[model samples]
Target chain A: MHPAGSLIIFTVLSGLGFGLLAFLGAGVVLPLGWEAFVWFAAGYALAGGGLLASVFHLGHPERALLAFTQWRTSWLSREAVLAVAALGMMAPYAAGSVFFAQPLPVFGAIAAVLCLATVIATSMIYATIRAVPRWHHWTTPAVFLAAALAGGALLAGQLRLAGGLFAVLAVALALHWQAGDRRWRDAESTPGSATGLGRIGRVRLFERPHTGANYITREMVHVVGRRHSAKLRLIALVGGAVLPAMLLALMPASLLAAGAALGLHLVGILAARWLFFAEAEHVVGLYYGRAAA
Target chain B: MTDLPETTDKKLGLVIDLDICVGCHACVTSCKEWNSQGYGAPLADADAYGPAPEGAFLNRVHSFEVTSEDGPPQLVHFPRSCLHCEDAPCVTVCPTGASHKRAEDGIVLVEESMCIGCGLCAWACPYGAREMDPAEQVMKKCTLCVDRIYNENLPPEDREPSCVRACPTGARHFGDLGDASSAVSQLVAARDGFDLMPEQGTKPVNKYLPPRERDRATAAPALEPVGEAGGFLGWLDRALSRL
Candidate 1:
């Protein structure tokens, strides 16, 4: 699993953006006039910017609209549709509150749910990949949802709620990592099974198919960042979850404290997200003789 | 449209014999040669002659050593490509309807015109079968040489996959595996050909024939010591010694 830069940005930014939108729609923070405008603008900018970043990774960005058609079977397609729906639904509610000072509670509630659903859809894009045993677990969605909720609470200035959610996020992250580390071996997929040569005897790669790297090796057989994973995990826990949780709990509620907490949390989450892809072992690696034992 | 059909009309695929493959990469070369010009996009190479060359290939041959208690280690040349599964995760995972299994022949293909090249299909495949063409920036895979297999323009004898036609040892066999009476199905029955990664539950159409057991006693018979030379040779030897 290659920890693609665009995808990392997309997942982290959009998760935070949608989390904020969810809180706003749920009436967690009620701001009027220009203040409402600022909040809604930040939400749209982060969410929209993240969505835009995703397109950069596509080979044919012009045909991305076609991606919306296969929602019935494709999580990526579902994500595209859900993102659009969430943003579209939130638009009117945001406009009414910001410009007209009319807080449409019912519309806001619906938009909030949609926002959360979009995050779920985004998480499912990775979660549904059975080829990557690490991500195929139920804990993938759990980790993602917890992060979004906690990050959203932080952005919405709900320090009390954010502190609780961060604790939950820490637990989810730990659970996901613990389970994910054992997923490949638990699946019982070895090189012998991958090549259907187990019955004969022990199978070991005698020769690789090519001297140079191919797309599959580049995309799925990544192992370069794995050496630093333990250190990165510590960073993710401290910066993304533990410190943020502690800061919100002990410190007085202030704009500066909240901003500093959000910055640290984002840095931690970025590192965690990087690990999410870098540490994941795709079953395809077995064929290339690159999978972890 | 990404949803798979209930079933395909014909389960057309390949059955490769590991024992016969010499790891020559002839099928690999032929597949690339035909597919580069035949299909939607030419298989592109990045820095082909540069320090670190990379390219998109539809098929590749990997060699592995199989060691058993009964015999010494033996090398098996394994050729890998798309299995074109009955339950292809690649097709269902396509965000665009570009990746789909044909209901008529069960050949999984990418409709390149509709492809957004998001690469989720490649990620879903456990076999590492599909490759993203670097230059074209679209997913490339073994189409089973669909252009040649069904092409009326080609000679009737040439109407098969390029790899099958190019195999020097006749190790690659292409036919309908769904039909019990088909030659490939019969061969599979006789040789105990098995699917790769059955637990993935992709229900692959393709099969692989395991390498036959090798004769451990490969040493040549010891030459008998000639106690005395044959009549002509003995006479010649004695006369030479007298001289």
Candidate 2:
């Protein structure tokens, strides 16, 4: 739960891009015009830039090409493979929409499905983690999906859609926050379970394995200051869902207002994503003698 | 390719006895010495002589104090390494096919050459088992001493994990757990060895023997007086009986 900057940017921005792509592909906006071109361009740029930024996280970026080959089992692999397929399908959809000013139902349909699938796959990368108790829940995907759609709707200038999605996102976020906070303190694994000492009463750490931090401690045992996390969670709620909903509701057709909403929503989503990473409690932390986890 | 085998022929793993392990870190040291120049990457240290040393280790020993219902607190030395689970989540989560389970022996391993160093395998492991080697930029874990155990160059008696062989108290054990009649399995059955974090459902092959409680009531014998039933002895005995 290091909350690496690259991942935060990648998940949030790509989520927005994919959400916009889905809306545009379904012709939910309108009859097709120059604005549609701008929307598609911006969407792809966000998605593509986010994807490109992800490479920096890898120590051996050249070998990242191999990650796409394991889509059968790995969620990360599935994300890699589905991202490529979705992006590839978006090429013709973008070109035809921008050049001919005609929305092809076939390309749009394929791109729409792929875009949604890609987002689900991205969320599954963390949601499927059995070791991270906070993330291992049904609400994880629901929150991710709702947040992406809400962000995408705002970015695409669909005020009504953004408003509705924000309401849904707010509900999802509330549910996630309630469940997440409860599970953070009450993880099923205990100190006894961690070391297999439950048969005896009151097991406690007398000594740690080492004085200095190892990979497990350094990577898995990240602590978020409670006050800071609470503040950030509030910011995520207000900026991500509420502020955008307010802005879009008051100034429905204003391009400037839409831009402002997207900016505020981005900041909020970034903070939410950061919290998502920071709050994740890996089960190994229990072994480190932080038994409260 | 990341799929684990339907069944491994022999589930070879370790059975560490918590009752006998004295937290001496013999296994930790021996594992480090033998693996420093291993078949895989060297167990490298970045700042050995510095104020803080950051290094990667496959096995570590953690000591804990647990108080039972009947007695005072006791120190429990727990050695943690890769469990080499039957349903190894690390193998399934690897984006690359580098992290794998050996079909023959059920030893979970990482192919250094193919590893991308993403650390996803480490994230998937709940036991704090998979450790990333910062020097090699790949995940490293207990291979159950695959190099030494199968090496014909060594003597038959020495054909075991360095940790198991180095333990002075013989608390560390290594054998085929798949066989019901194996020495390790029998020991597990006899000692009522239990799995760590059974809720995780990894079905880990490695088991830990809980510390046996010492009997305080029958431990010492009663002392007899040299002169019975006389003078001060009689008066003291009558007073003690009255109290």
Best by TM-score: 1
Candidate RMSDs in order: 4.8, 4.5
Chain A vs. true chain A, TM-score per model, equals 0.98, 0.94
Taking the tens digit of each residue's C-alpha lDDT, what string does model 2 give over B1-243?
689899999999999999999989989999988988876998777688899988888899998888877877788888999999999999999888888899999999988878888888898899999888878787889989999999999999889999999999999999999999999999999999999999898999998998897657655676786766878889999899999
| Residue pairs of candidate 1 with colliding backbone atoms | none
- On residues B1-243, what C-alpha lDDT tens digit does candidate 1 reach at each position? 788999888999999999899999999999989988988899889998899988999999999888888887989999999999999999998999999999999999999988988889999998999999889888889998899988999999899999999999999999999899999999999999999989888999999999998878777989998697868989999999999
What does the lDDT read for residue B118 in candidate 1? 89
Off by over 4 Å in 2: A30-37, B217-243
Per model, the share of native interface contacts recovered reads: 0.89, 0.80
lDDT per residue as tens, model 2, A1-293:
77777888899989989998887776676435677678888888888888888876776677888898778889989988888888888777777777877767787889888888989998898888888988988889998899878887776668878987887887888888888878767777888888888778788888999999888887888885555988998899999888888878877478888888888888888889898888888989888887764
